[model samples]
Target: MSSSSVRGVSATPVESIIEPLRECMVSMGSGHGKETGDRRSPERTVLGRVASIMEVFNGGQQVLSLGDLSDRTGLPKSTLHRLADQLCQVGWLERDPGGYRVGMRLFELGSLAVEGHRLQETAFPYLQALAAKTGMSAQLGILDRTEVVYLERIVVGPVRLPTRRGGRQPAYCTALGKAMAAFDGEAMRAVVSSPMPRRTANTITESFALWTELDQIRKVGIALDRSEAYEELVCVAAPIRDSGRAIGAVSVTGPAGRMRWRMATEAVHSTAAAIWNASFRFGSAGARM
Candidate 1:
């Protein structure tokens, strides 16, 4: 101080102290900058990890243990446990004795998405009527990545079917899938390229055979599933079209021996037509599904 205070002019200026301090601060922060840059390209993000966890349930598995999740996701059990706990907190997952299952929140969100589009609501009555008339389950479905996503199902009797709304079945085997794919060129091509796992003896495993069947369906506006997806189930389906392009398909399903092919096909065809006509009243854009 004594040296700097001579004649009211400081020998050491305040700027000298501040400049070095600033340089030192920047020097210290360079490592933090590098860390920030590293974060920009992480190996895996939290959201991606969560998606990997959720996707394992998409196959309709009721529940999975931590070990099962670890096996399926290849994520460490420690990480999975933490993420699963958080997912359970947010209602995306639920814990069970065995492990965890998809929670009601997912179902609630799915319902909102389906009903928000109004397609499910619009098709419900027609499906109900079809189920009542045929004494079998009536389903509405749309093609999703070479699979048929069941949007709605109206079961008339105690038909112990394995399918459920929001469940997915292969587009190559299910009647609803075939009916929709028969008209949509992109969907047909997707089915052609995907693995056609034979679920039963009647399942179409060959591409040429499936193409022939699709061509026949396009000609008749009807598709049939004769124990192709399930040995006990037989179904008849018709596409709901708008100006020659299919938006969705409707099907009537019953036990193989109990299904009357002639009656089910006629009812499904008319039901699809009626739904297509009704869709215009509900705004055709929503029917795009």
Candidate 2:
């Protein structure tokens, strides 16, 4: 105030002291100079830590202890504990005797993901029709990191197969998995190059033999699972394509003894065609977006 008055300028008691401090605070808070006040944010690190923890359960590892989770996620135990508590409060993680696993919050998020996929939404009605027409369970699956994840399933009756909503199957054993693998070209090769884990006696464990089988599947546009994933179950699958690329598969599954080869093949072909048509429609519409 005294300096400004001497220079023949006006000054207010409040403005004289507050303006400089406010400017300093603004400069300190500014990060990129894009705003009046900015701060260097740590949001990216927080998001990365959360993503790392979430990804640890992506490949069917459902449950983990604090120590195991820390080891698997490469996050500090103290930090994980803090984050885990926050996640648990929000229903993203649930503590049980086994350990912390994905909770209903994850299920809700997965439901949203499935809904966002145009193919899943478009193919649902057709899948229902296939299930009704064949009186068998119909499933849609997509390849996800060396596994086949069941994206949608329509079951008409109770079946003993281990397949369930959000379930994962070894890509080499299940019909839906094999159908996707056979048509995926280099992706299929990558899967075969990895160690193939056997889930049943009938599963194709040899890489070379599986390779030969995939060639046959490609030629015929169909794949079969005769108790390959689970004993006493059989499945027939066909590819669902969009723009000439197989994006997923449709399958009819039942007990081996009850599944007639001719009927199952017809169901697979028809369902695959329906799904393909739906995917095409979805793609054409999505172009507008």
Candidate 3:
């Protein structure tokens, strides 16, 4: 008998046993097998690809070609094409003359996500009150990655401050961002220690000075952005805590000339207290740092 036949004595058919074993070997070599069971599915790959594509829009990039998407997502052209097609079909992405951009479906999903956040729900009433009282734009924002994403806003009349309901602003320069960062411990340090970008002449460009200022914000529970993000705009922010940990911030923003330091400070204190109480009563009551 040949050596292969002699080993297993499978004279019936060599192809049957050998082929199955070869497939099993290949599966095991590629990090798939019974040892890992069927628990590891391809779902994670699909989700990861979708996430990669979504991340390309995080900085508010509105459009991208296949090459741009590939470069941004670090995915191969072929893979990106397949994924993009699926995303477009599902309304997560859309193609226009400019190329692929996030679609209204994603906006709808995001709106739902923001609506679900306990902070948004609990803070709206207080935000409305602040907007009503101060006659300014009141916003509820949270730290998402390195920026502050405004989840909800109550605009008093037609006031504008270079921001929108779903807009994002640098955490180091915005009153809401600073308010959230001050209580975030190491996260706050990392933000201030990182290079501070200059948004305007009044923007804080010094890391050390910003850190010192943040320390004061933590102690006082209020942060002031005096035209740091935009010239002639001022925002007074106060931290909103869940349990004992700060989770988000509420801000009243308007013309800097109208919001004097002392008045802004008082507004921040009163609004923050009301929001904090609402958060405890209606929102994530037990969620701490």
Which candidate number would show the highest lDDT if scored against the true structure? Answer: 1
Per-residue alpha-carbon lDDT of candidate 3 for residues 1-289, written as tens digits (9 for 90 to 100): 0011111112222222233333443444444333356544322355545665676675546788999988877778999989889989988788988788876665544433433255676777778878777778888887654578888888776556577766888899999999988887766877877778799899999988899989998788889898999988888999876445465678888887777667667876787777777656654422344
Once fitted onto the true fold, the runs of candidate 1 whose alpha carbons sit more than 4 angstroms away are 1-45, 48-116, 284-289
Q: How would you encode candidate 1's per-residue C-alpha lDDT over 184-268 as one tens digit per residue?
A: 7877888977899889999999999999999999899999999999988999999987655576789999898889999998999
| Candidate 2 ranges with C-alpha deviation above 4 Å | 1-116, 284-289
C-alpha lDDT of residue 168 in model 1 = 85
| Alpha-carbon local distance difference test for all models | 0.76, 0.69, 0.70
Roughly what TM-score does model 3 have, to 2 decimal places? 0.60
Tell me each candidate's TM-score. Answer: 0.61, 0.60, 0.60
Candidates sorted by TM-score, descending order?
1, 3, 2
Off by over 4 Å in 3: 1-116
Counting clashing residue pairs in each candidate, in order, gives 0, 3, 0
Top-scoring candidate (TM-score): 1
lDDT, candidate 2, residue 191? Answer: 68
Clashing pairs in 3: none
Give the per-residue Cα lDDT of candidate 1 at 87.
Answer: 87
**lDDT for residue 64 in candidate 1, whole number 0-100:** 96
Number of backbone clashes in candidate 1? 0
10 residues in a row with least lDDT, candidate 2: 1-10
